[model samples]
Target: MTDGDDMKNGSGPAAHSGWRGGHAPRWGTAACVAAVAALLAGLPWAAHGRLPGRLATHWSGGAAPDGSMPLWAAAVFPAGIWLLIALVVSLSRRRARAGARPWRGLVLAPTGTVLVGAQASVVRANLDRTDWHEARQPVWAIVLILALTGAALAVAWRIAVHVASATPAIAPPELDLPEGERLAWFSHAANPWLQLLSAAACLVATGTLVALGVGLASPEALWPVFAVCGVIALASGVFSSVRAKVSEAGLEVAFGPLGWPARRWSPAAIESARAEQRRPSEVGGWGYRLSGHGTTVMLRAGDCLVVRPRGRRSDFAVSVDDAERGAALLNALRRRDRAGIG
Candidate 1:
């Protein structure tokens, strides 16, 4: 499930196999993104003659329309949003060149389908109507669109998996350890921007809580703000920094400054370990990320310690300094354990 490439064909352990799929997947994804954007942009114009001057773009629970936009705006607005999403998703996919990022397809396919469907629905609802208010909510159309979105997601996911499976898996080489010698490696990484973000969120949460307590604002409104800020603060604080260590006991990865929550794997439990260069975009942004690449504790871009656990197909990665040495040390320790050495 790693977004990181398995390995490129070369002589060293650092390089394994080549990507036989070549640039086809990349070009295909770009084409699909462009097609979806075009479809969204074209849907409104296709039925422009029968549609009203203003479209009912938003609706409340009732049948009447609550928000209206000019016909030109309606066509451009959703298309603009779709393009923005496509840009972000495409950049992430491009960053993950080594493996098939199913997460990208999963996100883009459903989102594009929904946007296109919604645009079509809006056109159908406003067809032959004189005023935006005269339009009724497309309840059945919405339901059907949602169902189609699910189908699109399933198809995209299957395609991504098939593409990823085509990439061959590479085995990392075990480092050689000298006789009667103990070895250990340690590395730490942190992002100051994430720390600042967490602090800002905490400050906002505190202010909102105080406002709620002092009756400075409505309890219901302030409560939601407070809750959102609190959650952001907690998550950002926890993943802002990481410490990784490799020893005879295997690899230990600790999260946050306090380091109460950590993950450890025994030498025997690890099948392979390697250091890879990975970016936040490749794994779906900073902090803890779970994508086709498995699970990644991404604090900052650059070197990462990637470990494949025994009996698992996916790899777990953590961003840290000197990850290559750390990985080599871990592999060496695993080999030592396998050799029954003290």
Candidate 2:
């Protein structure tokens, strides 16, 4: 296809150049996923003679077990879940642009470690048990599993950072501003669904707090409920709306109605600015997200103002209305700043 067609369809050499991880990374990811799946699925069966007919799969706060799964189910269930997660990661990776940063390892490494650790713990607990009920909760094993999971996540994140840093940033489209002309552009975006969800969460939290205050519910149980609901409300409310502005100074993006939290990039600090179409699913579903596509403040899917900061490999994008004008203004400002510096 011609250059124009390639650019329009996002399938040209420019797009391909963004991909730098090569086949090694993809192959390694696949191998790790397969290995984890195999280990989880085979662990129980490997010790079949020593293990009971069923396994203690769940435990409450105490040493006593509260849930049980048959020998075959225990082995297959976790493996199936691992495979499903792998499938999703694969699909999302496919949807992401070529040469986008790798987020697969960050997700899979910790998940696989947790599942494998849990499967091992289950087998160790039921190794010589006569019945599933006789299996003791491996408290120490749980702690060790948590520690290992943290280590695995840390390793994965470090690897991802190295890979991202090694890849080159895509050159963003630029626009020219006329001499002696000053310009500014503004746009706003909001998701009513997120707003309503936030409101509902806030109401739930408020009701729970009131219940605790009036002695209508247990303080211990209701406090956790209040904490969860409050957190959801705060996050959803903050990301439900956004305002983007580009001017001679640079680009500024403010979040929420109060706009207490905002991000600003001076014209000099911005390498390039462009407008692009993006979706919540592309950035791993809504709000502020860090994924293969980079850091995205996704309020609603559509036009987005995307910018690459000087000396940074990843771009930052925010959903907004009239993003094309905003991006144009930012690019012009950056050019003007560059000329002044020169």
Candidate 3:
């Protein structure tokens, strides 16, 4: 009813501003430091010939002489040093933020570059080695594992920073709709059919990849199978998009590959459209969907509308930001259409 009410309802534009701040958390820094400390402490075991079977073997050559570092030292030393540097950076950032930090987003570049460089170094250094077995176990395996772990940690740290950053205290403005008109908030996400179709496509794609990797399926077969699955997913996504763009005289729908193409429907052939809220479970996950009831398109979030064509049992729904407002707009447009008002 009022601007204050609109803000309270989260319809104001100022509510969703970007986050601010730049720093990692203390716990993450501490964990990294601890891991480094463990690695350094274990160096002594390698020096004293007490290294475990897993560690004793080197990919480039047999273990270095008792007092000498193995060839893999080129890879390990740099990785360790970079990791330590990252730990220090994280710690300093944490302290600087005083427990609240914005997301810098810069840490990703340096960390990612260093890790990629380290891997390249290891691969290049071991390329000429005759013993393939030695190359496989500790050197490649450890490098791979560490690289993946570091990447994951970096991502997690970034997410934490984003979460900790200050957010703008603003909200979206509400839309004004006329009275006496029935409003519908249609959301494709309310439809279960589209979701199931999307999920099935994903599963099939994943299974195909797995089958190909394990040599259970031919590569040639994999491509066609995935291509088909992709098409199916695309179709469902299109159906969902189209369902979200309904109007009085006709509904404009988006579908297919890029989800860019649109479809228009006439109101005379039309049915009824009304707004309704769908529980998260009812939609079968968020986004465009197709259920037994029909296809629903969810573009933003919140409540949606269900539209049933006249004499047609199938209902198409679409989720939007403000269902009541959208319905009002549509109804107004419909009235204009009926009166020959553009």
Candidate 4:
């Protein structure tokens, strides 16, 4: 394919340079992934040779075994994700231009980390036990979650530092809002198309998980579904109905009735609050994204009120209309709070 075609498809010779964002090289990543896959694939046999014909993949505290996988299936499960990650990273590398943001590796870390943890968990679960009734999965779920969180935080911090440091800190124009006066702004937005997409994806995932969990899928397999479901449900709800508020309590953002995954920024905590133009694609797609700029909650790109908190790396950016007004009010509040605190 032509370089243009490769760039359009996001996979070309330039994409494999592996020099973006100070992360490991693409070849190095491929090698590491291969090593992990090999180690995981061999673990079931290396750790314990001559296992039972049918091993326990999952367990339940019940009269009968809930889930089981062929020993080979259990062994290969961890290495299996390597293929997916490699494909994605490969595509990401191909698609990216040589000088573009180094997001490809960061984006793959969470998934790769989770998959590696999963492989280790599965391998450990099936070892040294004749019984298939107890859930032997290692503490992989926590590891996976932590790994994902850590990757996100790392990427956010990198972006924050890069963007914030690069940004010139000229004093914002003053706005008149007294300390006694409660400055508050509220806005609500919903994207029907995104919500519909979420609903469809979640429905399919929920159905798949149900089948796997109940229809003899192992506990090792089912545990991750809970996490996946949580993510999907949260995304589906949050993207559809977004509520943004700026007040004395700082900047507050919530979604839907559950109102989970909410964020509140105190005036004292903010280093800078300003309006900036945001393009959704830069952050690698919308709805809770991370990129060279920072972490963003983008729903229809345009103006965003980006906040850089004190002593933190990632700048919190949310897309909203009339971002300038909100930013001005935020600065006024911050100055007021800074004065009061002093």
TM-score leader: 2
lDDT of 2 by residue, 1-342 (tens): 000001223322221111121353455456556766777887788778878888998988788788999999999999999999999989988998654446577888899878877887777777778998898865687898899899989877765664443333333333335566554555556666677677667656755654453334469889999999999999998897766667666787878755548899899999988889998889999888999989998877788889999999999999876577677677777767878989
TM-score for all models, in order of appearance: 0.47, 0.48, 0.36, 0.42
Tell me the lDDT of model 1 at 118.
81
Give the C-alpha miss distance for residue 172 in model 3, angstroms.
7.4
Residue 320, candidate 1: Cα error in Å is: 0.8
| Candidate 3: tens digits of C-alpha lDDT, residues 67-127 | 2245445336645765666666667665774333434334533454344433443343334
> RMSD for each model, in Å, please?
17.0, 16.9, 12.0, 17.4
Better of 3 and 4 by lDDT: 4
Candidate achieving the largest lDDT: 1
Model 4: number of clashes? Answer: 6
- Estimate the lDDT of model 1: 0.73
Model 2 local distance difference test score = 0.72
Show model 3 residue runs off by greater than 4 Å: 1-128, 131-270, 280-292, 297-302, 309-311
Q: Please tell me which model should have the higher lDDT, number 1 or number 4.
A: 1
lDDT of 4 at 61: 41
User: Stretches of candidate 1 above 4 Å error?
Assistant: 1-181
Model 4, poorest ten-residue lDDT window? 1-10
Clashing residue pairs in candidate 2 are: 19-99
Using TM-score as the yardstick, the better of models 1 and 3 is: 1
